[model samples]
Target: ADAQITSAKIISLDAGKITTGSLDAARISAGSLTADKLAANTITADSGVIADAAITSAKIASLDASKITAGILDAARIDVGSITVDKLHALAKNLVNNYSRTSDLTGWTATDGSIVTDATLSAPVHRVTTTTNRQILSDYFEVDPSKTYKVTLSIKCDSADGTRYFGLHAIDKDGTSISVIPFTVSSRTFGGASSNFYFWSKGGATGGWLNLEAYILGRYIDNQSDVPEGKVVTSHCRMPANCHRIRLRYLNYGTAGTARTSDHFSPTVTAVDSGAIRAENVIAGLLQSVTGNSWISLDNGQFSFGNGALAWNGSSLSAQGTFEAVSGTYLAKLDAGAVKLSNSGVELGYFSIQTAGPTGPWITAAAGASKINLAKLVGTGLYTAYQIDWGTTGGTSATHRFWGTVTLNENALYSGAIDCGAIAADGVVSCWRVEPHLDNNDRCGTTTKRWQAVHALEGYFNKLTIGSNTCWAAGSMSLTTASWASVSFGKTFPSAPRVFGQYTHDFTGDIGMLKIRNITTTGFQATIGGSGFSGIAANWFAILV
Candidate 1:
């Protein structure tokens, strides 16, 4: 009748029905009650619990400060969030090996000077009793060539001596001084004057040593008051690179017997935190020659050289094998040392080549309204096509325009179509050919005569007469008596002219019948004798065929 449990039999019990007293410890097998089989909040200290060593992170659901005892969690067991910048900085390693002078001067070397531990100053001091300058160098050190380092040092003068010059020098592997930062002290005061000096240098193979030097002046002491007591003086130098050595040097420039002292030489070398290695495709050195298609762009400008092509910034776009415009079109090109402009592209209208000789420029143009128009456009107005100007001086304002052919060498004007209002020539003879024709005159019963009028120096006349001998004659003569007078008509009529006539104004009588006796082409004779004619003046006559 009682509830019976069998081996391998599964039974479900009420939440509060099961009790520890109901089960026997000897009958319960080891590891028989799993975590899931246990009821919540059932396992307390008063009841029963697992062993302390048996409880792990997997066994514990969560934990708080109250659950964890003090000093139980170490740095490894603590969360990283609990750590702070101050703690990390406290644990940082100093890159400087001998930052403090507490140790002996084992890694330092003094040139022309001696470095000794001074008990009075509680630091290492470098002393130079000689008038000559001395230097102290440190042991060998290494540096990353691509890194930048800051070197700092402190200098203090124990005795007020002559003017002193101290400097920090960076020495290359070949013992060449690459850089120096100098500190000058004009005069040292009685009390020690300490100065903190700092310098920067980019690390490389050549920059292997950091050195310190001092120059002591001699013989120029005006008084003992100006001289400084030589005792414990110190210098401290610090740099980021693993340096070869620190050097302390003394320079004697003046009289002898001048002593110098320096102490507390501590140096700090720190590397600058530049986030990442900046690598660039920069052309190093003085690029004498470049061979492939490579471009480097910086700021707003771009430079490229390759395949016989070059470009500068964005002003030029195309770079096949030469310089070109943005549209892949060439305006000019340089090939094999010769420069040429495009002929089929944009045309250059006018060009000029000036040289020492008589060679001229070669200009070519396409077929069209191609021409070279030279003009000075002052304002909006029409201008003449061609204007030839002449002047005796620079300011002479005389110009001539020719619409037809004008030969400059021969001084000739062809086409014979001159619109000159008046003409003045310096020739011995000036000729004019005129077509004999009247306006609106028909050829019917009208003579269309053609003649050439010539003016010679012998006379001036408005009308010309040509005789059968081809002699030209023109004149107006006056007669005084009826005697036969030689009449000068410039040229005589041929056969005394079959028709002759005479007219007189001063004579009132018949003027007698005028007669022509001599008949020649060069000259003629005329006589007037009828009654009542005493003299004749202003006589006009003509002998016509």
Candidate 2:
């Protein structure tokens, strides 16, 4: 009853006529309230004038953390690198080396192309402009089938065509290869590369080509600390159970059967949850199992393999093959029976090489059980140049030693005892002192074995070439029942030699006189006019004139 005026009488109420505290927000009409009509400082959050849903981020130009209340911020709203690797998944490591090559291709091979490099590049850029289909291969290394591997590479194509391929080959223990998975040129996802691009492996079947997208790992980035290059391509591979060794390969096909100019950069291979790889190290047990020419172990330490077997045991060394020492035309080797030295095809068993420490290897006469014995091998027969006389007078032709031109540089000394054997010297025999002269003693050298060791002395029928008409070459031959036969002059004469012919008969009738002709430096001709002269023998001598 105080006002009793309801209805249309209150249609024009002036703000000056009503008290400020009398009207509340709910009493006003809902559609009539607008942002521009609101008075500054008139509405407070505590006054319940503005609803929470009515204010949005679009409505606020500036915001402070103190102004934010009651809700958590989304992860997308957080800054980058705010987290660390302790917050990420582990068990992954880079398996391939030299992928980001600053210099050489240590673990990679330019199988079909040459290595290309640049100064400004952080990695190598192998260009494939040389071959129509260029290929690159990684080191053939051991891998475990339980692990999953990833191969990533970034490529820039200057000129492109045809198709590019990535392949994974599985190798057996014997080095046999198996194609586990392949991205061949016959089947590829992308067309001829004409521009620079970034590729990806965004969730696909195993061995299938990855889908291409403009965005990379960050496309679905959830963690602030997770960062990766956007352009590098990645492919997945699982080592087959049949595989023993793993090898990664890439093949680049060109455009229109012509090689394209493309640069491949930072090709990498990675493995997840891989424990360790079996590699060669200090152990020789496994290496010894390998047959063909490999480093092996000995009793003392280690050594490499050669053609022969060698062993060293502290102070002693054992060699199996021929212990040979050859210089100029002189050869000295240790045989099964004796130690021998040969000069100008004249072999003598009298010396051996002994290792005397600091003095190195020196030639010494074989002593102890290795007694010096002169022996020579002819075909399947062994000939002893010196032999002991069986208590006989005349020396047998079996023990008749043959002598040739021997140039003795110095005196030949004899200190050790020598058995009863002959030494035939045809040329100059120069010596200091030679004892055990069998020419005087019957128990020592036989009469046929020993010589009356002379000094500056000329004896016997040795071709000495005394002066005019002296031929220093002598040999004997017979032409008994034939027309003609040849005989050697023993030494090449300076010219044709003068001949002296003599005939002898062993009680039988004498044959025709022997004739000599066709004189050459190496040999001369001996002929006979008569036949059936078997009973006669001719003793001819040629003297150089």
Candidate 3:
């Protein structure tokens, strides 16, 4: 690259149409160009000398493009202030009605029958002229003159005692007044003259009702202070104007002159506008509907509904569902899910320890020992009159047994007997029976203190069963006792002793040994048999530690 220095100032240059008075055309070679010789304007496109090309506007820079094809840049960047007022007219327009111009005094308060401004009355008192105490029956209301409004007043009192009377009065904004005759009069005898009170005069006959409520009590009768009268009632009244005060008086007749004038007999007034009252009613109606069309609550302990329904008492919510508690006993638990006991898929109600016994018929844990006497064991026919005992024996080697009739009831085997008892034994103890193993009348030798084993005498009879008749006399035995030498179930005949099994006495000494021998021709060797049985002999020593 070659560099060049210039002393003169260069104003402007156009690269597209290059023109340099100082540089000769021969200096700008066809293929040789230096950056120093180039003008400030850069070239944007290549000057091709080859093929035909279509350079669309989209291919050009935005600066060289038309205003309509400027893409996102053509849109206004700051549109907030750019929008005309006409386009924002809807959003800026006021949707709520202007309340100041309408002068809606429907529920607004007024002084007497006239509208009142910011004026207020101080001692605009009532003057009653009568020999007996009399109430200022009129000229009590005053309202702002600028607004038309209405008010509600509720009055309630005990029966009048001939000395008390109520009157109505109206006071205008102009300080003018008008009075009404005594509306209520009564004697002190019948609970004092008081009546439930409500009034509607605001609409004159068209506007909605004004709601008001009050409770008046006479100290003398209703046992109250201040008011001195025990009469309370809530009443609603609608008036066309606002109210300031009400005067009450007690009239005492004849020479007694026991009448008392109430300091302020005016029933309290609650002023409201018609629109607001309507809105409040609408809200109350909605609440009632959502609350299962129940009673609607209003001010002054009053409740009402669109259906003219009144609530005189309160109610409780109804129960929605029911449930049950599971039943159980010691060392037991109900399955997490329900387990069917009968046909019904009821949840498990009880869990108890497993026991073997009859559900009914025989008494439980029958008393006495269950004995199978060899003499009573018959060879054939039905054998009845058997006994079963569930009694506990108090002895070093206690044994329990049970037995009953040995009969086969149809295809089903019915064995009705009391629960067997526990037995206690030690060493080599053998047991033999005259009947079969299935015979209900079976007795067993006590191995443990609490064993319900079965056994019987020899020769007399045998146990019978639908299946193979278990010859009780000849059968195997188990080494139930921890220490046992040997045992033989059936009586060992002289020719050959039927030794089904045997057990080893795991200890020394005869402290836990047992021996039952010396049988005549009718007697035979009857001992327990099992793989663990050992030392099977007449004089064998069976030991248990």
Determine which window of 10 residues in candidate 1 has minimal summed lDDT: 199-208
Candidate numbers sorted by lDDT from highest down:
2, 1, 3
Q: Judged by lDDT, which candidate is best?
A: 2
Spell out the clash pairs found in candidate 2. Answer: 471-544
Candidates ranked by TM-score: 2, 1, 3
- The lDDT values for all models are 0.42, 0.49, 0.30
Runs in model 2 lying further than 4 Å from the true structure: 1-94, 111-122, 179-235, 257-259, 274-545
lDDT of 1 by residue, 242-339 (tens): 23333332232222356544443555455552322234644443332455465555555566667426666667654454443333553555333333
Best candidate according to TM-score: 2
Please give the lDDT score at residue 419 for candidate 3: 27
The lDDT, on a scale of 0 to 1, for candidate 3 is: 0.30
TM-score, model 2 to reference = 0.24
* Superposed Cα deviation of residue 205, candidate 1 (Å): 34
Q: Encode model 3's per-residue lDDT on 182-250: one tens digit a residue.
A: 112123222322222222111111122122322222112221121112132222122223333332212
